[model samples]
Target: MSELIARYFDRLAGREDAVLTDLSGGLRRSVTGRDLPDLTDRVAGWLAAQGVQRGDRVVAVFDNRLEAALLLLAALRHGITLCLQPANAEAQALADLAAGLGARAIISAATPCPEGATPLTLEAAAASPAHPAPDLAPQTPFTLTFTSGSTGAPKGILHAAESFLGCAAAFNRQTGIGAGDRFLNVMPMYYMAGIFNGLLAPLAAGASVVIDAAFGTPTALRFWPRVAEEGITALWLSPTMLSLVMRLDRGDKVLPAGFRRLFVGTGAMAARDAQAFLDSYGMAPLQSYGLSELLYISVDDPGQPHFGSVGRPLDGVRVHLDADGRLGFSTPHAFLGYLVEGALIPPEPVFATSDLGALEDGILSILGRSDDIILRGGVNVNPIEIERALAPLFKGRGFCVTGLPDATLGQKVVLVFEGATARPEDDEIWARARQIVAQGPGRAQLDARAQIAALPLGPTGKIRRAALRETLAAAEGAA
Candidate 1:
């Protein structure tokens, strides 16, 4: 694969004046072919000045701003490991990350430096004149993204420059993005998919990107008007945001205004929901499965989406299932080993993802987390299959299915819903859910003794499965 960001720099080097907009107030910040080299050089110089040697970690904590992008590319060009944490992340979280990852320098919008590390102010760095690129290693860690760990603390997943470039290549092959296309950076820079597709992929193809300050339903609703006015060609969204738009009364009026392709990832997307978005907006929702480890694994292409599947694996990426039925991959874009104890520990090249999946005639069918399966009285129950079934019945509704421990049957299936706009009777919904389960691919595995209940969700819109399970257990004990 090409040397990640440097290769992109070379790609942009040829073009003299290309429009690179910041979109803070819909302002356009032009980047010329000539000025491009200088900007990268200045970034390299800044890193060098801060003593950021090749392979060293440089943590960036900022919004999806232009300078944040510059810092990322520059750090990669210099072979410095780029650790991008969320701007809105709590101070405790940031401190924990810094300590855990051993971050030497930090690049942020903060005027003054943090307690221990070297701080590169966002305003100053962007204002600095362009200079020359620094010399560095080609096989160094280029980026770091934190995955939401079930244990409550997040783990930093590292990546090489080549891996990011490979991601760009996979995205380009899957999405067919090119020079005239424009992408809206709906996802945050902290997430691997967002950083690669929303930022790097667009720039690598010489396409323009609109960087938003934050991601939310209100912000996304505001974004639609801008997209229509600016003639945006593509967009990326999370399943949560998609659900929000579907819930909007004014959603129909704004969706079809502009946009050729809509790429959705970062969570499981039901096929029925994808169809709903397409039918309502007159645009196809390209669903994909991706993570911090392997950027983007699968994509639902415009012409040929496999409906329920996460589409097919992107170009230069191969998905395999082990004899044990766990999902593994051979991705061109593979990250360097994570930094554990002040040193980089290279990850195994062939990553066996914790996700469970199967390949039937080249199409990948993703199940829920491999170890998270519910065992109901010696029977196996996959939550995803249940969710997929329940999702369609309550179309445009928000719900999460999880496993609850039961004294009688090892575990019982439970359902937690956000709100019931389509308020069918519980008995009716339960009957439909049972019908769906009785006709599933692994129907024999269900014990026919599963139970479900509606539970509250956290502020982040994710179901607190553990809490719900605890509530169930407590209620069962009382009964």
Candidate 2:
């Protein structure tokens, strides 16, 4: 797509035979940007050949490949709005999604489509004849991303390539990551964090990206070596990934050259986890705040780290809290709207969030999500308070303190611990956590608790508290 992100990459091409997009893992197939404009134009031509036209909807259910990113560009260049579904989505779900969105086509390498939708491969998209640049509308969204649906059914969040470019620019204003910076990407490209923070953010600032799908302990252990190999200067990661790497970090005394920068977001990060990484690495990871609907609201300063806050608002972004401490942001980078009934419904971008937060000296700290608070016996309970109190028990392992249905109390607090081994000391630990929560601030009482064999993670590798709630509810029902 003759859009902001693509222009950032391909604009500097044809001057040098540079390896722009580097795939770091098993399959190193990549999108070389030497003639990237030419490739994207051909891909746009391929979409034209497929009978897709302007104002059309296309869903690219692609994996973490860099080519997938290019196809996104192609879709945008053709003046088409595009959404990406999970590559591993069930056929029926994919079909239902496509049918619901009235998508003209589905693009993927191996994902199956229902009988009605057209599926195209990157090979065909790349081989077709070149098409002319589009006369793009100012505010048309090039990327259509669906939320993780942790709370309910997923809703589409629309963002223009211009929005992403603006997001990148805002981020660059804070972090100063630009030319000569190589970002290592492991997060899924289908979502906001991966696409905006991992891919587009760097490219928009004249930086290259290294896409690696591999993760977990083995990958985390080998991370710095790979950073050294790839000359990666910046790190973009989710909190879960950061915790994993922090727990299993080899504790290198002298770090790899140009590997100083690290960032964590896409989910909440506990103060202890953030502190641990800083203590180990001698540099604090930059903490940030945002969601798919709006992003880059605040980012931490790497020099003087705020222990509990998500840092200050980005340039051109304003953050204010309501009477109830609910946070709201006003930014030009906000989403266009949510896709509904095959048409775009304008979003209330200035809408207040359900999050309870506070600002102290221009720094923002989130208390917790209002929806995550448990009402027990007319007492409001913030799960984050309990989570913080029990952070030591988890020891880099994940845990969640949430509410469960209770007839008498209206709701009850339940602690679910994440681990592979069921500790013989679990009963004692649960008792300790309960006592701590009861004695601590919030005066939250635990009704019951259990240890899970592993973290109930969603498809995005984020801990799914909704799934945990369901499991606990089912167990209670069985009892």
Candidate 3:
């Protein structure tokens, strides 16, 4: 077992009855530390009985449910290779992914397995008779997850016990999230934002997590109230979810009372949204920055939050910025590499991300993605500059700006609104947007406008700008 998991079991040595997790929403169960040794043993032995020996991969399709968490811990304990995919995804697509993994078995009742592949539902796997478990050493290849596939097809990210646990430990030590704190996690378990930040970090801290499988707009509406009722001390949310909750909050003030932490990540939080959260709760949401490959690079100190910043670097993380503001980082805990077609593809020597950001007084602020910067009329126009200027015109509803191919200017700036309602007054709204930009300091110009019922967003709430850009370019070409 990894040292981290061993230490976790050590922490529960005398406190076996202590609750480790409270699961609700889709599945309801509360597991105490006492359940660990026996539960994990059962899971491992069952797989062993099914001929899933060490180094053999198993694909587990799950949400933020208890089964997934137990299975991960069990897999890690026995050193079985496990690939986690979200259960909420399309069944056939997930089946295809599972098949591509060449996994020994597919673990899901909801998803159908590809022909000639073995299927092991969670219920059956847990109930199987115990057998001898094969134990692989700590640094061996373990969990496999995929990238968001926003820019292209999802790439499988391979990680070992050392890389995963080391990063989890750093988050716990830096963020000081542990023991007495109970987390409310609405994020999907399959994503890094949800699994690493929301699950593993808290677990490493000896803190209990409340997994909400039914989290959505309705849940977000009652978010604060629910937190208050459950005695939940900390919570995790994406900026997109924050924006939605802010819109639906009804301005009915509710004191946080005892809720000490509100962690935001997965995307850059707009300044207005950050301010709005503080204005409502009297506590600023602690912003952190990292990627699936890097685990976590930086996290805000809960004691001192500098609004509009993702905050300082975590321990052992080195960050640098290019002259043009593109961000790069070197971390001790990067994932092994991408696993493709039975071959391991190592990571690039230099870890420069496509994100554009800045560091001021050692605090990092993500300006936007490199693609978010628009080039029009031989001038670099920031879409954020245009969006901020027009916030009032849209009354802060929801929107974004980007540059598209133009016959005259090389790139024509365009506006994308979230809703597709075609109002008769759209022409006036477009004219007003133009006037707003005309008066802004950047000399940015608005050329056209369109509305989409929903923006193309990654699971973690980050807008898929590259995908959006493609769609817009296609539309422009058709026009």
Question: Which is the leading candidate under TM-score?
Answer: 2
Q: List per-prediction Cα lDDT, in the order shown.
A: 0.68, 0.74, 0.75
Cα lDDT tens digits for candidate 2, 1-479: 34564466554463343434646436566555566667778877877877678788877776677566677766656678777766676667777777888887776633354344455655776768998876777887677887667777677888876777787788887887867788888777666676677776876666677877635667788777877888889977877787777666665645678786888886677788788777777778888888778867888887787977888888888777888788888888888887765577786757578888988888888888888889999999988877877888767666788899999999988888777666787888888887888899667788887667776885446677777888878878987
| Model 1 misplacement above 4 A | 1-5, 16-19, 25-34, 47-53, 110-123, 129-131, 151-154, 249-258, 393-395, 419-479
Tens digits of lDDT, candidate 1, 324-441: 6888888877777665556666667678877888888777777777666788878877787787776766665556666667679877776655442435464576677777777878
Clashes of 1: 4
Q: For candidate 3, write residues 1-479 as lDDT tens digits.
A: 55666776555443554444544544466667766666667777777776777778887765666666767777777777778766665657756766787888767522344343345555665686654445457568778987767766778888887777788788878778778888888887777777776777777777777777535788778887777776788888888787787777874666556788888988877667778778877888899888878888888878888777898888888887889889998888887888878788888756889888888888888877786678788888888767766776776566778878887888888898787796676678789999888888887888878777777877877777778888878876787
Pairs clashing in candidate 1?
16-33, 42-131, 337-346, 337-347
TM-score ranking, high to low: 2, 3, 1
Provide the TM-score for each candidate, comma-separated.
0.84, 0.92, 0.91
TM-score for model 1? 0.84
Deviation in angstroms for 26 in model 3? 6.4
Report the poorest 10 consecutive residues by lDDT, candidate 3. Answer: 109-118
Native-to-model Cα distance after best TM-score fit, residue 85 in candidate 3, in Å: 2.1
